[model samples]
Target: MFLRNQWYVAAWDYEVDRQPIARTICGEPIVLYRRFDRTLVAMRDACPHRLLPLSMGLKEGDNLRCRYHGLLLDSHGTALEMPHGERVTKHLCARTYPIVERHRFAWIWIGDAELADPALIPDFWPCSHPAWRFDGGYYHIKCDYRLAIDNLMDLTHETYVHQGSIGQPEILAAPIDTRVEDESVFVTRWMPDIDPPPFWRDALKRDGRVDRWQICRFIAPSSVIIDVGVAPVEAGATVENHDQGVRGFVIDALTPESATTSHYFWGMARNFDIDDAGFTARFKAQQGGVFLEDVDVLEAQQRSIEANPDMALRVFAIDVGGTRARQVIDKKLKAQGAAAS
Candidate 1:
């Protein structure tokens, strides 16, 4: 079972156009498109008659026409025109979903549309904040979304997975503190006065001893924002507030497409180089490369988990952060189940 009545990102705001696109979220196939007025719409992907995927239909004005028989549906999923001019009734409509475009993302509520409050959407302010430049790409990984959550919550794997780009030996030695507050989980690591990694050195534009930090915050259901950056040793940047340094918030939102497949939206919102479009493009490319490494590891790990079904996964000291996040998910899921019953 998955968390319901919560906002799950469906696509980047830019991904939706007048042409319909099909996406599966929480095992529900959905079709998304922008109306003539540029407002977005999300609805069940199937046509009510014969159950043909509406995403394969043609866009006519703000409505969609099923390619197979030309059954037309308005943006609200109401059947407007029946094929062969047959009389259309209100009961011929398709189901629609609640969608909101915010912080450069389009979010859809998976259940209980009446309970899908816009206020419940995850706070991704850094992506929309005027002071930051944000850009990244998406990946469809063949693995359970929870595995991706675990990978993000536990950064120890970076020592090997991303060693060529952003990894550093100092990260392995840094003491990690995992804490839980309500439904949120925080795993913070502080590496003070250590040699900067190659990525940090390039971003800082100078090589010297620096204080680096990685604060991985998990917002329940499936979102992880990693606060990472470095500052000169003399800068005196503390873990509480680190604006004195060049910092970036690594934005991640995982939407489950199935029990073993996920839609991974990843990006970096940086306070520095806000005006450098070229830098943003270059960095986005580099970041995409780094995440591809993770995709490979995660896909392999998923296959391994399936092959060794008798062997249950184990948790250790390094998994505390992910463990806490899972606990929050389990609690919420239980509450939702009870409410439904």
Candidate 2:
């Protein structure tokens, strides 16, 4: 079951403009656009008149005019005019969702409007922080969002799936520590005084022994922020804090499109080389390629799971992080269901 009360990333800020874009979140079709003020407006994709997708309708100023019946709707999804008459029926309004643009993403609350609070949105501070440079792309993955989360929370797959990119023998040799703090799940691995992976070595721009770290944190309902980087051995970087060297936060926010599909918003925010535009572009492309590998593996895993209907997924020691994350999600879902009932 999907968590309806949480804020799901609808699209990147640039994705929504005068032209409305259609996105399905938690199985609800939504149309998102930016008004004249550049503020976001999210509403049901279907028109209130005849269920025509409003995303396909024409943009009349800040309003949307249904192409089929010519039903005009304001930014708030309120009917302003009818097809043949200027007088529109009162109370004929389409459902609008609470949307807020932050951290370069438009987040839509899919549940009770009154409960929609901007403060509840997931913290993606590095993306907006002035000291960091962040950029990435989106991926529509054909797999359950949880499977993507599972892949992220457990980095063992990196040794296989991303063998050519960021994977290293040190990562597999390092011991992982999994812990839960309230609703957050953390899986930390520190590879001390080892050769940095090619990705980190290039990011560091040096060729010396370094202490590498991968701290994967799961922030429910569906986001994993991985703190990764390396510092020269002399710099003495620790697992607690690694700002002494070039560090990056791998930002991943997954929004469920349906039971078997997800919207993957992935990026990296780095504290060092904040002014290097070339690095940002090149790295974004590289990161995109790496995640595409994940998408391929995840889609195959989903198909395998579907084919083996009688089989169950087996969890092992390395799966503690994902297991704990699933538990946290289950607990929140149970609470949400109990409250609704």
Candidate 3:
């Protein structure tokens, strides 16, 4: 909830082609559209003239023609044409945001203009490499964005909450190590002498034998990247000669729309072949359902917290990562006088 001066994924690259799409990030309504040249642009959705939503407007060539007064806004959010005049006036323009399209997603900076740095933005797995494949999309959640981040940082809950999906019983007893650096927190757990789950059996080519496993990663205010690796098993354990084992990464970006609402944008990347349409579709569907399950629980938790704001909560060692995340958020919010904690 305190994620200001950060870049958040706004929409999938394919979602804003040739059409005006409206979204809210950090409580600010925004509109995104592409020029005829396919370059993407983003601006406050409201028209500067009358405060009307510009997303309700139309795309005329390279400009967005406001539906209210037919004002033409260029890619830079400069008012190119007003019904009453011909010269472009800087005073009659919407608040523009710096936008960039990369890795099949559109990213927007929602903070102080001077603090916008693309280099500081978290990098997506598949988006950064050609060896990986990704599925891009998002989900609207009823819970606050902080809750979504807390859920991701705490893997211990998966054993019970996601028992049917990526969860494993052995992970519950595994010891976790936590670390914090530069406002980012990371947690790592190693599970040895454990067999691969049914879903990962094919991917890892395991043969009912014990092997080293690792889940380690970093999480910032509204984003995370988890790297999961499995040690190589003996040969002839499964079909033909598949690579020793597989390593996969899960990357997510959470954007807060308001105190009680958020958008979860996530994707998975693996070293294995996910190029086939069948495999991609199956994986996306499976993971998507697991995310929905998380949404249900988090939304309920947010409601309970909202109902009892003064309730004291207890924290265990397993909650270290989540607690640290909240601390960083609280500190940032307090510095900016934003609501947090």
Candidate 4:
């Protein structure tokens, strides 16, 4: 198990309301509930008083009432009242985890409490900008989280793996540049003078003129934001004009449920001024299918790794981003170990 000290997505902010939701992160079961003031609280799911799952209890105003013994727990996880005892006071409290809600997701800190900082959380650019239309969803995959991270960092696979959906075969041999910066890896590819992919074909034609294409970015350990735009194609020379269309931004994160299980959270934004609910839902579904395809391959790879733990895998130059990501993870885990010492 890796002691990743970064923000991990716990649940959708809207998923936790009046009711208490139970979630397990890094093998720790936590129960999350919202106070009347709208602040969220997370405590160990087990009640210290009777060792019962607190999630089985009820929410009463600002406290959670244990169903077995009717004990009321406050936002601080302190045992405020016990129906049978008058001597019990604030001394009894469950373990509380630091939590923050941002970008439509709840982030939980499973590491050292002092290191938990809301400001340190990664920014989901699309979620914060009003000019972008955002769509988000989740998926449960039977794969090691590292595999998912590797898959995202390696974009070359898209040409073959996602050929029908999001990939362009014409750009299969495009040159790619890779770089690593402070726990993040970036991969960029520039494709010029190519026919627009199906999704961009219609959007690229402006007043009967086709445009040039550029796919510029990919960030890691688990996020990618590509800027694709078309300009007029004339006499083998690119003419700068208004963008045919733009794929606003895409942000994705994979949270590990265990050594061989993960939860994927993804969000996409578009610059176009289209916000019909039905259209958004359909788009989300289409993007979700693409994610499912990745999940299938990742899970299979994970299973193969499990079956042959000692097998050495060969890597090519195209795996530069993935190699960098693994190095970052190794460095973080090593630093965590050194700090513990």
Q: Per-candidate TM vs. native?
A: 0.99, 0.98, 0.90, 0.87
lDDT of 1 by residue, 89-182 (tens): 8788989999999999999999988888999898999999999999988999999999999999999999899998889887888899988988
Error of 2 at 91 (Å): 0.5
Worst lDDT 10-window in candidate 1: 164-173
Decide which is better by lDDT, 1 or 4: 1
Superposed on all Cα atoms, the candidates' RMSDs to the truth, in angstroms, are 0.8, 1.0, 4.0, 3.3
Candidate 4: TM-score? 0.87
Q: Which candidate do you rate higher for TM-score, 3 or 4?
A: 3
RMSD to native, candidate 2: 1.0
Cα shift from native, residue 311, model 1 (Å): 0.5
Overall lDDT per candidate, in order of appearance: 0.94, 0.91, 0.77, 0.72
Counted clashes in each candidate structure? 0, 0, 0, 2
Candidate 2: residue 261 lDDT (0-100): 94
lDDT tens digits, residues 1-341, model 4? 65655678887777788789887776788898888888888889998878789999988887888888888888788888876877777788888989998877888888778888888777776676777778778888888777777777666777777877667775567777777767567766656656666555544434433343433233323444544445445534332333444544666777777778877887677676556677678878978888888988988898898899899667788777677777777777788888888
Ranking by TM-score: 1, 2, 3, 4
The all-Cα superposition gives candidate 3 an RMSD in Å to the true structure of: 4.0
